[model samples]
Target: MAKTVGDFILERVQGWGVNRLFGYPGDGIGGLVAALGRNDDLEFVQARHEESAAFMACAHAKFTGEVGVCAATSGPGAIHLLNGLYDAKLDHQPVVAIVGQQSRSALGGNYQQEVDLQTLFKDVAGDYVETCMAPSQARHLIDRAFRIAKSRRTVTCVIFPNDVQEAKAVEEAPHAHGTVHTSQAYSEATVLPQEVDLERAADVLNAGKKVGILIGAGALGAADEVTKVADLLGAGVAKALLGKAALPDDLPFVTGSIGLLGTEPSDWMMQHCDTLLMVGSRFPYSEFLPETGQARGVQIDLDPTMLSIRYPMEVALAGDSARTLKALIPRLKRKEDRSWRGEIEQRIARWWREEEERAMKDAKPVNPERVFWELSSRLPENAIITADSGSSANWFARALKIRPGMKASLSGTLATMCPGLPYAAAAKFAYPDRVPIAFVGDGAMQMLGVTDLITVSKYWRDWLDPRFVVCVLSNGDLNQVTWELRAMANSPKVPKTQDVPPMSFAHYAELLGLKGITVETPEQVGPAWDAALRADRPCLIDAHVDPDTPSLPPHISFSQAGSYAEALVKGDPDESGILTQTFKRVFS
Candidate 1:
């Protein structure tokens, strides 16, 4: 029996355990969509836009660690997927992108919706990108996409021409017993650094009087090993934003986050430590790291290129995080110093107090920090929170506490907006039993989040647990960009481009057959979340946050202060208003 190229492609992807797919149907991929409809095992989710579909795919991979798949039509539709594909590429998530192309007859003729996908997607799909020129190559191309995506943990693309989708000259079943290879790449295998490397890493760490730990997304499964190592070394742990949930925030010495969104304890601990143990993190901010010669370091990462890239290392261990840590543990020595750990605990306590004080500030509009703090207290222990890139990122990094069993992610590397809603929707889709929440800023919620809200509405019944929440931090501004402009560029205030019209996200949700509530006062923040969690359907909470409130960094620089002063003298309209709000916050 022979199969259409589309049939063979679908069979190959489904064989890889991809039951869910996100895509937008169009003339370019109509044959592929028809092939998809012929199968009952695969659920082809129709998204409002190709961009959201790509984001949903990336989020699916992030939450489940599976090869997320998405498809889009040629030209504009395929172009729309670039941003979301970059999200997966930068975060090192496995994703397979199936792109539609113009018919072979129309190739390079300036036909409608025709694009040279191979060239356009080269950067994102660095590992693999192939156009199925013949029906016989369909299975091989699809196999290569998923294989490369999973093994390399990056984006892979398969371009299917419109004519090829209908071509019938391929194997009927690519997953048949005789055709498949039983290789270890298709299964899990334990990986660890060499014994000598592990021993050297342990020795470097053990020799230091004061040690600190920095963890990232690569440390997700090695939480216990990381904690044990930190305990033995009496070291404080500072998590990269991508590793926020690697360890429970309640851990005595775990500093919440590092960089501009870092806690005071994290900044101090990393700088003061005599030695550092960096596991699975490529923390980009060198400023937050210890001065080059200030501390000796041991770096552990699966990618040899990533090891010791950020900081100079005394020892580099390249392998699986959990396996390497387990091997190194026996070689490690217990430190006698409780003073460093004690000081970290004290700083942690003080940071919490300061955060609480800020959270309780009585500004005319509700404080953004309060929203995260309230959500932190109210969120379920197993909730999966997805935050958008903006001021909300800072608030979540500093204020939200990730409890054990809970998972959270953001567009950490891409740092793009509009992924919050799509990410939450995908989280709910992947783990229906767990609560999924999206914490987004007003500007981001307006950008593409609102457009993707219908995705939640569309998939509400698919989940066994019907609870999904979108917490809109409605401050009517790109709060994060505004601060960056003021602090870094010496700008007066948020530019007109950064400001957005006020939106009632709650009303929008209500109109779409979901629960929606608008909370203006700080007092209403807690109840809004409570109501959202208890609601039977998807929900949105539009919390009116203070636009004048500044997302001040943990450490303020002299240059930033000077910029602020210069901006005020240049007559920013909001300067007096922000000053008054700050005064009220400090006093009240």
Candidate 2:
């Protein structure tokens, strides 16, 4: 049989080194599905929904430095991919989404499952989104999507109409006026700032006695450079949530995550520093940073648009984080005064002790902080960790101590829910030998994680090492929002909107032929993780943690405290537990 456009599309993506495509089956994409079945070079991962598939693709790009690809049928399936694609776009992951459209002839007729896919994908895939009107258009569309996605480190789209997908393949475009030729070749440029700018940044750093370094996801590859710079300047380093794994938490001068889910040491470092250097991170909270002009600032990022957006910088270096830091290191003068670094280390040590004390405090049942804190010590070497939004993110951000070589991430800019399991699955696919763990809340588990468990069961047997674990904080409440109501809105928890229905996630995992463990007490948290890690297959730990455990910010203001008191006075449903837990956390 002669090759079709569908065949060429798959072949081209495979040529670009895409080993797997994540999507669900639908008739609109029947041609591509058939072609996929015939081809053995690419693997098709069947996700429960298009959203999960997109999340998987985004995670694939994040875990591995490759362009992630996801496919879906037209209409609702295409719409479902928007949230996950936005996650990729906002977090700056390279992902290409290929969606099927209705027959080309029926596009404007408003046929069944026909939607304006071009306009629908415009915002998320703004860098590039094109429809393949003919077989001749397939090659360039596929090539451009992958190239642009990789080059821009953002989401791109290619729409394939059902009719066009089944048309005969156009392996090469004709050498004519209207025809366009494209190549699959792409290489990352070495982005470096001018020498004058690097020297200026170094001058600002050397001038100050108290220096602070803040890094985000962009600093992932420049860990050594960041460390050398930090050590030379006798500075403290704080990680943005997305850059948690950029530096190991064991470093005394390395403060943990910064922001609402941040540590006291990081907040202190930012508040007191006279000089600040921000690398490869666009952490959105300005209040968490030093007051404008309080500190002389230098910012570094690959994307010029992101430079100096968060903080007013004296020097804005538009270049790759690693390379820029490497160039700046030599110009920097080592600070002989070790007082600032020593002070920062003392604060970090005290903060960790406080964190341990907070985690061990008694609660109604299991304390959620305890769950993550226990897991931190038991995490296998080189394990990949993913967390969902909500209270789980709060704990994952604060309690977990990410060591060197362990990879960790979540929905950073989007802060969306339900990517935990999908990300872990993608990480496992990227590195089948490494353990992948997910920390999720009951709400996210029900929304998406439960369904993705079946995806895990189906693929775990083929993995070189099958030690995937999903740790579900089964607190029967939308815990994060519930606390936000009390602390931010000055309102009591409205059980109608905030309570999550109780379900046995462990039992659900068992039903899918995976190991399941239930942990109701704090003592069982550590043992359960051990069992899950040792299990021959994927495991789910249903940890029934206390909903009243508050995720306190590093610096709580008077207004926030007053709001919490007012909410309690208004008669919260979990008033007693909240009071008890809050007292222990704050005063204990």
Q: Identify the leading candidate in terms of TM-score.
A: 2
Q: Which stretches of candidate 1 lie over 4 Å from their true place?
A: 172-185, 581-588
lDDT by residue for model 1 (498-572), tens = 778977888999989989999888889898889889999988999888878877766778998888778788877
Q: Which candidate number maximizes lDDT?
A: 2
Worst 10 residues of 2 by lDDT: 579-588
Model 1, backbone clash pairs (residues 3+ apart or across chains), number? 0
lDDT of 2 by residue, 176-279 (tens): 99998999888889999999999899889999999999999999988999999999999999999999999999988899999999999999999999999999
TM-score for candidate 1: 0.96
Error of 1 at 122 (Å): 0.8
Checking candidate 2 for backbone clashes, the offending pairs are: none
